[model samples]
Target: MTDEVAEDDYEEVVENVALCSECDDYMEHEILKERKVGTGRDLLLKCISCSAINNLQIREPKSISIPFILTDGPHSARVELAIDEDEVFNIGDVFEEDEMLWTINQILDKDKRKKKTILAIDASSISALRTDMVRVKITATRGEQSDSSSMLVEYGTKFTADTKIDYQGEVWRIRAIHTGAGRTLKGTVESQDIKRIYLHEPPNPEHFEPKTPRERRQAWKEGRLGYNPNPEIPKEITKKRVTPSNKRKKKRPRK
Candidate 1:
């Protein structure tokens, strides 16, 4: 009797690395979250050293596995790797001897496997609702107006009009929210600002220009404006007409 080995006996491992700005060294980064965006995977990695945030994109590879059968070899066996009617195989991807080492080299239908755009929503909204700070996957997009932003969350996300969230290093208060019957919900937030700069008209540089002699003197004294005491004219290059290439050419056909 001979012993047999199965394909499920081995484990696969993948390593992800990132650089820490504070530590200035490459460190093993822990993946906080992964979102499918287009044809790649958007990964949020946290530096193990200083806990800094880093973004990484991982694209799909061309390798695809298909089944193959060993017929001419010493052992004629029936396996799942045998070519099926719907499967497509590439050259150099199949081996007659070892089934475990066979590597797929061709790409299948890439468009079908592609995912839609995924937005990284601010996780601080959960904390602002007075809930425990835990990792949550939410889909969101940018707001239409400046100084204000909106986010899309899954249905049943606990929040109210008074909810506060930290987005892009700034704290904002939720102003309005619209919940849908579907699994998605939209929410808007505005900056918690006390005052805003309102202008009647855009300031013109020429209008603010110091036209009067006293204004110009005051400007000079205050170091608000200055001009070059001595300016140097740039030297221009004069192009010289040279003869065309003297290389011989093939004879033209007679008209």
Candidate 2:
């Protein structure tokens, strides 16, 4: 009873489309009728293979530019994001940009009210924090002053107390770990839980100081030091002459 529908002028929507009851799976379908509502499409579709009718409503996706703010520790940068009008974003969802993954922590609706979830059409802005890496704060105490710096470490990196670490072109030992609960002098903690790492600057190692050439000569002449300038050069060897073929220093007492 269905007319030859291809002869009718209807806009076709070709997506890997909706399920068909007769085919019992998704198959090619032709749009018999399509009406565009404010944000959605009401479509009457007939399967090309089985001639079954399916009425479906799909949102017409439109790109909406929303403000996306990315946070890194104390700094933040704002960027524009083009999301589909139908996109629904939830807190704790991850988004990737510039090879970094960020987790959505907050979203603001058009009224600037905080929301746990938001549709792109209603979202005014979104805030996300870096999740793939974290900046670990480091502090080294001197006699009176303290030096503070930060290092970027992979997320969940384990840091243990009394371990040597490299920072600012110097080697430091992790004296303690502040877990935000308390400082621990021993044991391990992951990156996320650590608030700040207390560091101990390693003591300068003692080394032998070689005397200068002038000082060496002066000390040797003063009988205060032994000088060996060319230690690598072999020293001449002198052999003592046999004492007059066997003359005794003093005639041994006759035995």
TM-score top scorer: 2
Pairs with steric clashes in candidate 2: none
- Number of backbone-clashing residue pairs for each candidate, in the order shown: 2, 0
Off by over 4 Å in 1: 1-24, 30-33, 38-40, 64-94, 97-255
* Candidate 2 lDDT by residue in tens digits, 157-236: 99999999887887888999998789999999999789999998766553222268875665465444566553422122
Model 1 C-alpha lDDT per residue in residues 99-135, reported as the tens digit of each score: 2333222222333231222111201000011011112
lDDT for model 1, on a 0 to 1 scale?
0.42
RMSD of each: 33.8, 14.4
Scored by lDDT, the top model is 2
lDDT of 2 at 119: 87
lDDT by candidate, in order shown: 0.42, 0.84
